[model samples]
Target: MKRIFVLLAGLCCISCLYPQAPATEAILEAFENRSRQHLLHENEAYALTSFSPAYLFDTLLPAAEARYKKHPDTWLQVHLLRLRANAASNHRNLNNNIGIRPESVTLTEEAIRLCHLEGNDLLLAETYFDMAELFNLYARHEEYITMLTKAFEIADREGHDYFPGILLYHKLAGMCKAAFHINSYRESIHYGNRALAMLGALKRPPDLHTEIFVYDLVGFSYKMLHQADSSIFYYRRINELLKGRDTSTVFYKLWSAIANGNIGENLSAQGNAIAADPLLEQWERAGIGFGDSANISLARKAQAANYFRKGEYDKALQCWLFVFEWSKKEKHFTNAAAAAEGIASVYRRKGHVDDAFFYFRQSQVYNDSLTAFNNRSGLQAVQAKVKLENLQQSLANSKALLKVEKRSKQFLLAGIVLLAVIATLLYNRQRLKAQNRLQRLAQQKREAELDARKTKEEIENFVRHIKEKNDLIDSLRDKLSSDTALKARQDILEGLSEYTLITDHEWEQFKTGFAKTYPSFFPAMAARLNQVTPAEERLATLIFLGFNNLQIANTLGIGRESVTRARYRLKQRLSLSKTEELEELIAKW
Candidate 1:
């Protein structure tokens, strides 16, 4: 850092009275030597402060200027450009620290070219990381994300980086924080927690001030979750830690004051306004930058609780009802839940149990959602970091792949353009060749599509034709079954005809056709009819069917007792014992 030397030079002129200490001179010499050898290794990326680059340019420009004044040299001028580039890049990084973008982008690009010209991967990665921040500031999220992701890959491969606690890793995480501001709070929580966890897994915590700010952010995130109890506890712990570490830290006052006020509200809900009042007043102070109305909802909640505990239900309900209105404006889950729950409690005491039950359930559901939101938010951070890292790696691979593909496409495109130009030139002399090639390509494409279409059409046509054949068969069958002319003949045969009212003429043929279609029907009918027979002779006569008595008996498969029993069952079924005869029963049916 030539800046360090310039300041030393200024101090040296005034050191007669102050006395430049030997240790300070030794430090100056070391810095001057180190600045001379800048960008020689990757270690400088971590060890070099922002001031180092400016100091390096400050020391080198004069030397390079003095060298050129004597005689011009190519190497000297290039080296000066290189130093200037590094110095400009570091300047960009400082601008990045202060939230500037376009200037940072310009400086980062220059830095990368300088590094590339000098074959420096480590400095290039740093430059690229800075470029990512510029894009992130502009809300060019996809491109910005792509850039750091590339740097992360370079850092992993050729750039010589260790994970987590490094400045680059935090830079990657900081880029991810842009999402959080865009109401991508879920992603914000994810990336923030991932950054925290990565550092945690790094075997040692970073003592860096930037990293300490990350812890502050994490603690504040819990409060936003409306987990007041958990929020208060963590904030109390962080507040104590921050005070012990940096007593003058402004955020310590700002965030911790808010956290303390939140805890007081929680206590107030359990019915303690006296305790909460002081914390609310502290947050309401001008130095904290918090307005009185900002915490009025909390004060109202405390007042409602005090009234409720005093057994003044109407006054309590009125306070809680106002709290309910205030909570909506506040839109804070803890304050809202407390407000709703307080209203429910007042209703329960007033003996409106049903209303109390409804509000009570609403309160519980909101409270549980808040808890799950907080826990899941933290876990999501871990997952997002993995995803971010993975996405970064994927983007780098994609870039490299894109480069190869782009180059190949460019080559192919160039060839295509050249071929078209050649074809254009040849058209005057050999038009047929070009025409044939174009036609062949067109025809091939058409044939492929035609084959696909034809195959699909053939399958559809075959299915349609089969369906038509089945329809024709169904139509013919319907015509035969519904024909009325065939049913008009006496003792009509209905096999190939229609339903008929038949007579005794041609009854044998009718019976043959009827038995063919209804073979089992007759057997069941005969058994039922035999039970109704009035005499043993008729039961035997039904089985006889023009056979001898022995053959008939065998066909009936009955001893004389069953025949006699059948006759008795028949007489009972016919409601006739002595009045019924076999011949009369058969003739009647």
Candidate 2:
């Protein structure tokens, strides 16, 4: 409630301080032309590339601000506010720009409120989504969630608006990916699956490559969780999707490769080095030297295993040596230790007893370190559980105490009220008794004094009512809703109907508006991002943002089998190929 008050107070201040400028019909018409074109095609792949759209949207920032000053009118202010907020929303994707400050959170929130005030539901959803992203970047998960929920509410209210639904679904899936990395895999799938389902229901060639992203994340999470069959399923789905698409996308190709690499790893782990190479080779070829430190290590390990299986001690040792040196440089302790153990094994095979012992001891050291890390994590988990239990008990006790206090206050108030009534009756009784001994004037005087006392008591009772309300809020750690007319507003739905969510036609217009504005730009942007990251990039992005492989896969509308393979690839591109982690690689990327 306090949070609500603060949010409301801030909004109230903004509304009061920033008066809307009176805009002219001419300027209003001009803006409508520009906005209609921009919003209509905003999601098109080439919208940003087209000069007219770009000029009207991105490059026209200065023009909008200039127009605001030039006209200082109602239509212009509305246009400026909407465009400015939207421009910030758009600029969020360009953090690669290094020095640009995206629109402030306060500005975004205010703009969203303004849109609501103006009944621009689509605009409100769009602005809120941006705010959610801002919260995510700042590591404020709860805030991100609140904003996301609000965005969904507005978008859903828009009804059948493709853009709002799609964008909201996209963000939810992305949030799921982030959740997976944080070890909140279930939630990851929850969001991912919803997003995938939404995508599956849409037309092909895609409105946005969101389905691909969710699938990649799902697949990667599955791989990390070691669900080999499920991982393969998602990877295979990706493969099918990539038949006509460029297999050269750093991310997409990497997953196909990782699918192969992991299959090889699984084989090699079971002592079938000969069978693993073909898969590993495919992964390597797909790599294209894209700064994949982890893949290089994994490839080397696989090669070492193959040589070891073939009884080529020297070759096996060489591969292991490379893995050892590189894993150490990359700080991949587990892989480094594995390489050390393999090196030691190779030395033993070569009859180098002392050298074998040295590598064996090194392996032991890493093993001990890993044991310690696991122990520490386990200890923390146990402590956290205990602390949570204790907190829950404490909260229960606090609630009990609050109830007792409330009852005590009620008793005291009841006693005081009874005394006031009794005293009034006694005083009136005394006045009647005096009627036989006093004049009419004196009785009238007593009546006047009694009326004054009654008025004072009423004023005191009102003050007490206010105080009690304040106390109740204080006890709840919330705001005192102290509105005397609150009895008339007992239903929350009565006032904030705008916050209610319902899916329908307005949502379709939103999608159409953005698509018309961008014109294939969604796919184009996907293509551009893919050039560096690929379709498989979603795995890393999803995981980095958080999501478990299963959830990720579900969101992508594929089996977890495919997600596993994608993770293998994501690990390589993100330079975490050798790690069993679902998080570090994402952070590195």
* Whole-model lDDT per candidate: 0.51, 0.56
How displaced is residue 17 in candidate 2, in Å? 40
- TM agreement with the true structure for every prediction: 0.35, 0.42
User: What would the TM-score be for candidate 1 when compared with the true structure?
Assistant: 0.35
For model 1 the local lDDT of residue 355 reads 90
- Candidate 1 Cα errors over 4 Å, as ranges: 1-123, 133-146, 156-166, 169-173, 198-212, 222-237, 243-255, 262-281, 286-589
Evaluate model 1: give its lDDT.
0.51
Q: Backbone clashes in each candidate structure, one number apiece?
A: 6, 76
Worst 10 residues of 1 by lDDT: 6-15
Error of 1 at 516 (Å): 99
lDDT digits (tens) for residues 1-589 of candidate 2: 0111111101111112211222222323444343423222334322222223233244455656766676675434544655454445344343433422346544654565455444566555555665555545444444555566666676567663435234445577756665554444556667676677776554433432445667766765665566756665765666666567676677666766765676666566567778877887776565537667677677778778777887888888988998899877876667778889999998898899999999999898877876775566456545644643553366456657777998999999999999999988799778876776677778888986786666556544533553454344334322224442465544432332222121235334333443443345345435434455434544444454355665455334444677888776655654443645747533443
